[model samples]
Each structure stands twice: as structure tokens, then as C-alpha cells.
Target: MTSFLTISLDFELHWGRFDKTRLRDYLEYYQETLQVVPAILEMFEHYGVHATWATVGSLMADNEEEWRAYMPTVLPQYKYERYSAYRWFDAQPQIWEEALFAPHLVRQLIDCPGQELGSHTFAHFYTCENGGSAKAFRADLKAAKTIAKSKFGQELKSLVFPRNQINEAALAISKEEGFDTVRTNPQDWYWKHTVDENLIKRLFRTGDTLVSLGQKTSYQAPQRNGEELLGLPASRLLRPFRKGSLFNQKRISRIKEEMEAAAKSGEVYHLWWHPHNFGHYPKENLRCLEDILQNFSVLKDTYGMESRSMGEF
Candidate 1:
């Protein structure tokens, strides 16, 4: 079998970060993201790369009214009130008109060749949050599919749970809703499903990007649960470009080495990141991406490694 390279992006704007971020602080980053998407599409097209955009369903709306209309009846009820996406919207609904809505961008994504639209859940729903029931998760997914079909005239086939919160019960609902596959966390211990946040795990995750501190994450094949959805476990996160970072070259070198190993060994190497990760330093970020893709081209020549979207893989 030929080695495969897959890229999936979590394309949520303000929706994914409402719990931890204040929009005013990152307004410039969001603004740059609008430019980043088109550039990313151009680069992908030029490199013959196919990617899945796991979009937040709310980003499918043209305005706040459309977004509100598609919201699920029962929202996530996390013990930490500030973690609620709905409550944050309730506090300042008007701000969504500008910050949260991104239907135009989603339209651009659909038009871009080789780009597949997938679900990141409606409203960036948190599946593992304590107070949110399985019923609420299903309701949220139903809203996601409904809006996606109504807006794009296409059924969503892949999902990436918000905050990497994978709920087994929710996977059944995802399959019932018609997803072909779902992106899961890497099989490393640090990336496993957990409600409790740990500083050591967080630090290790960050450090892994710059150096191979843990396991080699490449996979040879996907797994299937009883739900019948293919489990496309992630391999690595393409960390964003940081200014004055001494490890920039080391990070890129680590990614290229991993890709080469996967290609030589005939395994799948999946890389993912958010569009906003490129938002802050568009030029630098694009250059880093180009470097990775350039290495992929070399791998293709030597080993016939192929590029695939999540659904395609």
C-alpha cells in the first residue's frame, strides 16, 4: 500500500475559543485569518494537496439570525459556566454578526478544489463536559447536519470533536447522522480523553511539536468502532509560526523527518491545525507549510506517497 498524507483543519473562528479568549485581544488575528484561507487554498492547490475543513456549523450562517435559527434546543451545561458557548452568545449576540459569522469564507472553501467540508459540531459543542447529556450531543449534531445540508447542499462526512473531547456515545449519533469517519486524538497517553487538564500533559504536547519526545504517531490503517465510522487518528499538529522562536527550524525538521519515516514505512501521516493558527503570522506560517509540502513532494518522487483528504483516506 502507498503511504498517505492527510490534512484536516479545525476551521472555527470565534466559536472554538469563546471560553478562553476575548475577541478584542485577537481581533487582528481573526482579520488575518480571512486572508489566510485563500492563501492556504492556493498553496494546497499548487501542491496537489487535498484537505478536510472540519468546520463549526455556526460558521455556515450568513448572519446572527441564521445562526440562532440553527441552534440546538439544549446547549452544553458545563459546570464551569464560562465554558458555555451559548451563554457567551447570549451575553453579546450582536457581536456574532461580525466575529462569529463566516458563511462567505465557508463558501470560498466549498469552491476551492480539493477541499472537503466536514463538521466540527454545531456551536463548537463540548461533548465531554459533565452536565451535557448524550441527548444534547445528538441534538447539537442534528442541528449541524441540518444547517450544513441546507447551506451547502452536501452531507458532512467527517467530524472532529471540539477540544478533542471524544464521547463514545456521541460517536453512535455521529454515525446515525451520516459521518463516514471521525478524527480522534493521537494514541499517545497525553492525548487521551480526559476531563481534567494537566500541566505536564500540556507541556509535553507543546514540546512534542519541536522534538520527538514521545511515540512515533504514524498509523498504517484506520480502526472502526461498532458505530461503523472509520477512526482517523491524528498523527501530528502543525504548530503555528512564532516569532523569535529558537526552535522554528527544529520544529520543521521534526515534521519533515516524521513525514519521511511514514512514507518509507508505508503508513499514514496525518497533520492538522486551525486556520487561525496561521492568522497571526501569515507569511511565516505559509512558508512553514510550504516547507512541509516541499518535503512531501520529495517523498512522492522517492516512495510514491500520496496525499488524501480525511474522507478519501
Candidate 2:
């Protein structure tokens, strides 16, 4: 198989973090995300990078009324009430427009060349959380497809589970709902589970970005499962740029070295992050992205590495 690089962004604004953070505290951070997304798209266009924006279905709404209009009939019933985004929306019905919804940004993704509109589930559904079921997951996927087709005239072919919480039943339901591809976590000990409370695994994930802590991050393209869903395993996260951090260059170098290895071995290297990751230090984060893309250009020219959206696989 040919060497490939895939980029997927978890494009939820506040919905992704609402369970763990106060909206008031992160307002400015999310507001900045509104600006960062377009800039990221511009860089992708310049670099001829193909990406999948795995968006929260709610963010596609133009306003609160529209978001409500598209809400799934059956909501995820996480045993931990806070994990349910629908319940959170119920408590705070009033919209924080810039922080909550972004149909305009969704439109930009559609307009951008080589960008694919993919699902991050309706309401940022957490599949692995307690009380979540296949029934709720199917409802979420339906709502996601409904809004994307109704608002943007696009059918979502790929999915990225919120928090990389991949569940087998959820994958089966995704295929039933017409999704052809989904991003899965790397097949490493640290990535096998998505428990947020596991500090050791989390530390290993963070350390792996700078120093190798696991197996080779890049891998051969995954074959389709019996369900016919393509499993696009993530290679690494493009961690947010830290201002004046001694390890910033090392982080970028780690990714470059992985990309080089993938290029030489004809494997797939998948990198992902949230657009809001660039919200805080836009200039620096974007520069880091450009640096990586520059390396991708070299790999493309020298080794025939190809850029692909997750859906394309």
C-alpha cells in the first residue's frame, strides 16, 4: 500500500468540555477557537492537506432554536448526569452563540478543498460512559446525519468517538447508520482504554509525544472489519503549542520523525487535535502546524506520501 497521512479534528467548541468545565471560565478560549478554525483551514489549503473535521452535530446549528430543532429524540443517559450534553443543554437553554454554535464554520469546512465533514456524534455523545447504550448512540448518529444533510447538503461518512471512547457496539451501529469509517485509538497499552481517571496511562500518552513510550506510532492501513467499517487508527495527537516550553521543538521533531518513518515504510500516519487546542496560542500553534505540514511536503515530494481524509480511506 502507498504511504498516507490523515488529519482529523475534533471540532466541538464547548460541548466537548462542558462536562468537565464551566462555560463561563472558557468563554474567551472558545471565542478564539472561532477564529483559529479558519486559519487552520487556510494553512491546510496552502499545504494541500486533506482532513476530516469530526464535528459535534449540535455545532452545525445556526442558533439555539435550530440546535433544539435538531436534537435527537432519544438522548444518551450517562449514569453520571454531567456526561450527558443534552442534560447540560437543558439546564442552560440560553445560547452562548460564539461558544456554542458555528454553522458558519461548518460551511467553511464544506467550502474548503479536500476537507471532509465527519461526525463526532450528536451532542458530543460519549459511548463508553456509564449508562450509554447502542440505542442512544444510533439516535445520536441519526441526528448527526440529519443535520448535516439538512443544513450543509452533505452526508457524513466518517466518525470520531468523543474522547476516543471507541465501543464495539457503537461501531456496529455507526455502520448501520451509513458511516463508512471511524478513527480508533492506537493499538498500544496506554491507548487501549479511555478512562480519564487513569493518571498513569494519561502520563504515558503525554510522555509518548516527546519520547517514545510505546510501539511504532505509524502502522499499515487497517483492513475493513466484518461490519465493513474502516478503522483509521490514530498515530499521534498534535498537542497544543505551549508558549516557551523547552520541549516544543522536541514534540514537533517526534512527529516529523514518525512521518519520515511512515513515508519510508509505506504506512499510514494519522494525526489529530481539537481546533480549540490552537485557540490559546494561535500564532505559535499555527506555526507548529505549518512546520509539520512543511515536513509533509518534503515527504510527499521525496517519497510519494499522500494526504487523505479519513473518509477517503
Candidate 3:
């Protein structure tokens, strides 16, 4: 059998830093790199590559004026999360100026080919670990689903929880909302690939490297002690580089080596990262992605590996 590859991206917007003080600094970064989205589509189109985009619904919910200014051709309701909005938004509906940017960002992603707008959840609710407001999260998903149906004409299914935070309760809630799969950390929870505790804490992780690639496992249904109510473990790891830049030949080599090995193994390699990172380092990141896809093309020919979407995985 062929080793499968799943390259997924969480497309969300970022207006400022998690810290309010650094808001302007981050907005400038967003302005400089917004063009990366189109560039990303160009590269993928060149490589015959497809990816899953865990989307943000709030982008469509953005105020309307900004949409006409920044992304004229793109539809706003179809995309969200790629642009972070702490600075773009204001307490009393502050900076209503930036709100228009949201819809355009959504439009670009929704119309992009081979990019599935998977849910990143409204406001990236970190439910499992830091339960700031689970109830609010529930409301966000409902709103997100509504926008998806009305704006994109698509039904939402898979979810990439904010912070990769999940548990049985989260999954139960997700399933109730018609979500079949919720991403989780693969460890003592479910489909643990290896036995080494430390090594497993780095490679096979989401948001952050919780562990390393310890072992590989098959796709199984949820069990009593499963990791998530519905589990989808991200199985591949990049070189842990920042999203914006091409680090060096060494880093690229290391990532390709790991991908090459997975291609030979017949196991599923699910890869993910944030879209705004592409905006941050558009040129360098595109080069890095180009190299990654080159390796993927090689494996596709040599091992007959196929690409899959998050729903299929």
C-alpha cells in the first residue's frame, strides 16, 4: 500500500500580538504579507498539491467596508482566522476601519482551489485546557456554521480545535454539533506511535510540540479511553521552523528526510500550520513550501502515495 500525505493549513487572520501592547507591530506585518495568500495558491497550483484549510468563520462576520478596500475579488464570509484581529478591532467597535479587511481575507481562501475551509472555531476557543468560556465557543460554532452555509454553500464537518485543546467532553459536544472528527494529541490518549515519553513530546504535536514521533498506528474508532471523542492525530512534523522564513538548506533537508521516510511507510502523514505565517514570510515561506512539495511529488511517483483531506483521514 502507498503511504498517504495530508497537508493541512489553518487559515486565520492576526491583527496583533497576543499582547495588546504589540498590536501595531503585528498589523504592519499583516499588511506587508497579505499577498502571500495568492502566492500560496500559485505554488500549490504549480505543484498539483491540495490541502485542508481549517478556516475562521468570523472573517465573514467582519464589518463590510474593509472588504472592498483590501481584497476586492475575494468573498469575505468564506474565510476567517488567517488574520488575527486584536488590533484590527476595538472595544467600542474600535478601528472599524480594519474590520473591512476581514471579509476579503475570507473571500480569498474560500475561492482558492484544493483548499477546504475546515473550522478553526470562532475566536479559537481553547476549550479543553484553558476553559475561558466553553459556552461562548458553542455559540461561535453555531454562528460559524450559519455563515458557512449561507456564504459558501458548504456544510462544516471537521474541526481543528483552538490550541489543539480537546477531550471527551469536547468531542461529545462536537459530535452533537455534527462534527465527526476532533484533533487531539496522540499519546497515552490514543494511537500512540511510540513508547518514549520525551521523544513523543515534540514531533507529533499541534499548536506546540507536546511530544516526538515515538511510533505509528492505524486509524481506529474511538474507544472508552480514546484521545478524543472523535480523534484525528496530526502525524507529521516540520523542522519546527518559524512559518515565515526559509531557514536554511539543513532544515529543509531534515524535513524532507522525515517526509521521505513516512512516504515509504504507508502510514498517514498529516501536516498543518497557520496561513498568516505565510503572510509573515511570504517569499521565504513559499520557497520552503516549494521544497516540501517537491519532495512530496517525488514520493508520489516513487511510492505511489496519495493525498487526502482532513475529512477522509
Candidate achieving the largest lDDT: 2
Lowest-sum lDDT 10-residue window in model 3: 70-79
Give the local distance difference test score of model 1.
0.87
Please report the candidate that would top TM-score against the real structure. Answer: 2
Candidate 3 lDDT over residue span 94-144, tens digit each: 342342245565667667666666787754454533323445456667766
**Comparing 2 and 3 by lDDT, which wins?**
2
- Model 2 C-alpha lDDT per residue in residues 1-313, reported as the tens digit of each score: 5899999999999989998888888888998899989999999999999999999999999888898899988887788999988788779846577898999999998999999999999898888888888888888899999999998999999999998888778888998899999999888888987855498998998999999889998898887757698999999999988877999999999999999999999999999999999889888998999999999999999999999999888
Sort by TM-score, best first: what order?
2, 1, 3
Each model's Cα RMSD: 1.6, 1.3, 7.6
**Once model 2 is optimally superposed onto the true structure by TM-score, how far is the C-alpha of residue 115 displaced, in angstroms?**
0.4
List ranges where model 2 is wrong by over 4 Å.
225-227
Question: Of the candidates numbered 1 and 3, which has the greater lDDT value?
Answer: 1
Relative to the unseen true structure, what is the C-alpha lDDT of residue 199 in candidate 1, on a scale of 0 to 100?
Answer: 96
Compare candidates 1 and 2 on TM-score and give the better one: 2
Off by over 4 Å in 3: 15-21, 64-101, 129-134, 188-230, 237-247
Q: How far off is residue 63 in model 3, in Å?
A: 1.3
